[model samples]
Target: MPDDDYDDDRDDETRRPARRRRGPRNNTDVPCPECGARSVRPGPWPWYLGTIGAMVCRAVICEECGHEYDERKPHAHLPTRKRNLAIVINLLGFVGIVSVFVLLGVWIYFTMGRR
Candidate 1:
């Protein structure tokens, strides 16, 4: 009789330890954009380090839509402004050359008439 009680107590203690070690269940349910099915997987890390500890995120491409999005530093517009200024300077130089030729032609014509 005492042996039976000891066996019952041992079973209860083992079941209690099992219940205490129980963990929560994981639920990861998401649909995939490519096939419209529930088969989504974890994506890889996409980041790169630039100058001065600056990090840039890589592009995210959509498999279903075939679209790509890039992330980078924007280029400065100083080069374009310098090019426009050079064009304007060249245009002014051409106009000045034309004016000099016209003035020389008029000066020669007037001098020949005086002779």
Candidate 2:
């Protein structure tokens, strides 16, 4: 191998700067009820899973005072309810698919054994 083939062609000035990734943005529209600051952001989790509990509500957290609360009307829990319902439907679909594959395997084993 020749040493001339490994030489650098481009200069540092020609290279583009690396882009910075941004995290979740603050919800400027919704203000904190405790401190009344417009620094509310989305909660860690949207649904109830493990320790994170935001079920049946659009949970939000204020950056200024660290106050957490639901963004939607307290009485109207339709949106979050619908979200949970969708999750149930998806789980059922997964179960159905797995059951179908299991049935197919059983049928194949019985048919092949007779032959």
Candidate 3:
């Protein structure tokens, strides 16, 4: 009985640990735009990344209706104040560029005339 207990302990010590369970990888599930199915998957790799449509849009394919469309949400317009600020900044940049050119031209003319 003592030798049997020692042998059992040795077997337990040499036993491997249990394997772990893995979860899903890249399980991007969304509603299909065309068929309105709730099982939309991500588009194909590499080739899908190379297309112009991929650049300007989100690439997703509907498994139900086979419709490949941009998955991007409709863009919301900026507030009027923010739009006005952007326009003002753009005009200021233009004015600064023009002022730099005029100053350079005036300096060149004065320097050459003096020489």
Clashes of each: 0, 0, 0
Writing each residue's lDDT as its tens digit, candidate 2 over 14-93 gives: 57577888654565766666777766767655333333223435666677777766666423344565466568756877
Per-residue CA lDDT of model 1 for 18-115, tens digit only, reads 44663422222332334433322222332222222123322333344443322231122333433444566567779999999999999999999895
lDDT of 3 by residue, 2-104 (tens): 9999999999988968778754333344555556665456654334223443454455666667666545631222233234445665677799999999999
Q: How accurate is candidate 3 locally (lDDT)?
A: 0.58
Candidate 3: residue 97 lDDT (0-100): 100
lDDT of 1: 0.45
lDDT of 3 at 28: 46
In order, candidate lDDTs are 0.45, 0.62, 0.58
Give the better candidate number (2 or 3) by TM-score: 2
Output the lDDT of residue 6, model 1.
100
Query: At residue 67, what lDDT does model 2 achieve?
Result: 70
Best by TM-score: 2
**Candidate 3 Cα misplacement greater than 4 A, ranges:** 1-78
